[model samples]
Target: MPPIRTFTAALGLAAMTATLLVSAAEAAPRNRYVQVQGADGRGYVASRNAHRTSSSFTANRSIQTNGGYGLNRNRSAAYGEGSYSGSSQTVFNSGRSINRSASVHDNGDGTASYQRTVTGSEGRSRSVSGSVPYTPPQ
Candidate 1:
């Protein structure tokens, strides 16, 4: 009877230990990543990189006109506009990731416009870069 009691105690201890181990494993967080496709529409090497782009323009005009009352008047007008478009992709040897952004602004007397875009990718480790192609704008 004593041996039976000891065996039961040992079995219960083992079951509890197994449960704790499984729960601990499930509680652990996993590392994640993303990747993006290239201009050719193909997957890139495994890598994690952020992409960006920007463009802007400005114009100004100044003129002098003589009024019918023999009075001289000066007129000045200035206009400016800017826009941007870009995307980002993060990849790991195990998987892929991607992110994208775009913006547009019109000022003064220009037409109103807006744009939004999102891009994604999946591929190997060689695709992401640390600079240049993935350099973010200030």
Candidate 2:
């Protein structure tokens, strides 16, 4: 090649190399991190539920000299609990069943109180309560 052509070719190649380096640097990736403000506690829990139910019918034809009684009960109840807290908690529940119906006789004390509850399935029932009564000074 001629001297002028050789010098021009070298200059062009140098310019191309400089441009490739500049573009490579500019195209490289960069990372960023976020800064958090003041806070306390961590994590949470949540849930929901729904249900529907129905019952059927029945009939009987009989006669007894002694006595006869029939009772059909239909009851439905739904309960929900909501706890919005950052603290951890543990829970447990239990229940049972005992039914009896015959020549019924009820007796009550003057200062007595009664309570009734029902449970699903054959589970057991358990409850705990705390009480403190005041004492009069002599």
Candidate 3:
């Protein structure tokens, strides 16, 4: 084939391959698990699973100790169309927990509105909401 035709074909193949690679990377979630044991018979297990795309992500993690102490947490977030939102919760085996959530929205005038809330183990909750001028990093 002519040099021009060959170059075009190579370029097309490269583009297709890049697209496939990106798609495959985005389609699979990453996960990890680990366990450790001590000579004294104390051990702990931990695991985490996370999935992410260009604009959104979610993740969860948990750990348990042999002494009946454990913690688990989950979080997720997304951003699009000038808005973002996220929330998370963490719990322990001792009946204590904490929860939090937040959201922000662009006001279309160089400002964004935000609201956030947090709750403690005793079920007491507090919230703060306001707007602020936003300037993204250079």
Candidate 4:
């Protein structure tokens, strides 16, 4: 081929390749995050796109009261390639110095589970575990 024709063909091929790459990147999933603060509490949320098919979600909250009560919660759902997983935890403290907590997880392939725990200022502790299906809302 003549030098001018060869150069034109190469340029065209390069342009096409660039366009494909840009399209793929645009189709890929991305992560997003948000946070908020209230007069007595704070919260955060996170999510990510997954393989142009599904998405992951996460959130957490913390709060306190002048009477010495406190509450906290954290949760997350993650998707990777062909699999997904989720977890959650919550803790509450009574103004009288007693505390309780619970945690849960979804293994994403048909299995789910949880754990619960309680503690008191007197150094006593209690815990439990179980399983249940977990699904996120649309």
lDDT of each: 0.28, 0.24, 0.72, 0.46
Q: Which of 2 and 4 is ahead in lDDT?
A: 4
lDDT of 2: 0.24
lDDT of 4: 0.46
Best of the candidates, lDDT: 3
After superposition, the stretches of candidate 2 with alpha carbons farther than 4 Å from their true spots are: 23-138
Model 3: CA > 4 A from native = 1-27, 136-138
- Cα displacement (angstroms), candidate 4, residue 96, comes to 4.6
Model 2: per-residue lDDT, tens digit, 1-138? 355434433433333223323333343333323323334533222222222212111122121111222222222221111100011111222222232111101112211111223233444543212111212112
True-structure Cα RMSD, model 4: 21.1
RMSD of each: 31.5, 40.5, 15.1, 21.1
C-alpha TM-score for every candidate: 0.24, 0.17, 0.75, 0.30
**Candidate 4 runs further than 4 Å off:** 1-96, 135-138
Candidate 1 stretches with Cα past 4 Å from truth are 1-81, 107-112, 122-138
lDDT of 1 by residue, 1-138 (tens): 255433433333333223323333343333324344556555432222221112221122222122211111111111222222233333322343344333323322333233333444542222211111111112
Tell me the tens digit of each residue's lDDT in model 3 across 75-136.
98766565667788999999899998867766778766666788999889987666665543
Greater TM-score among 1 and 4 belongs to: 4
Give the range where candidate 2 is weakest over 10 consecutive residues by summed lDDT. Answer: 79-88
lDDT of 3 at 31: 100
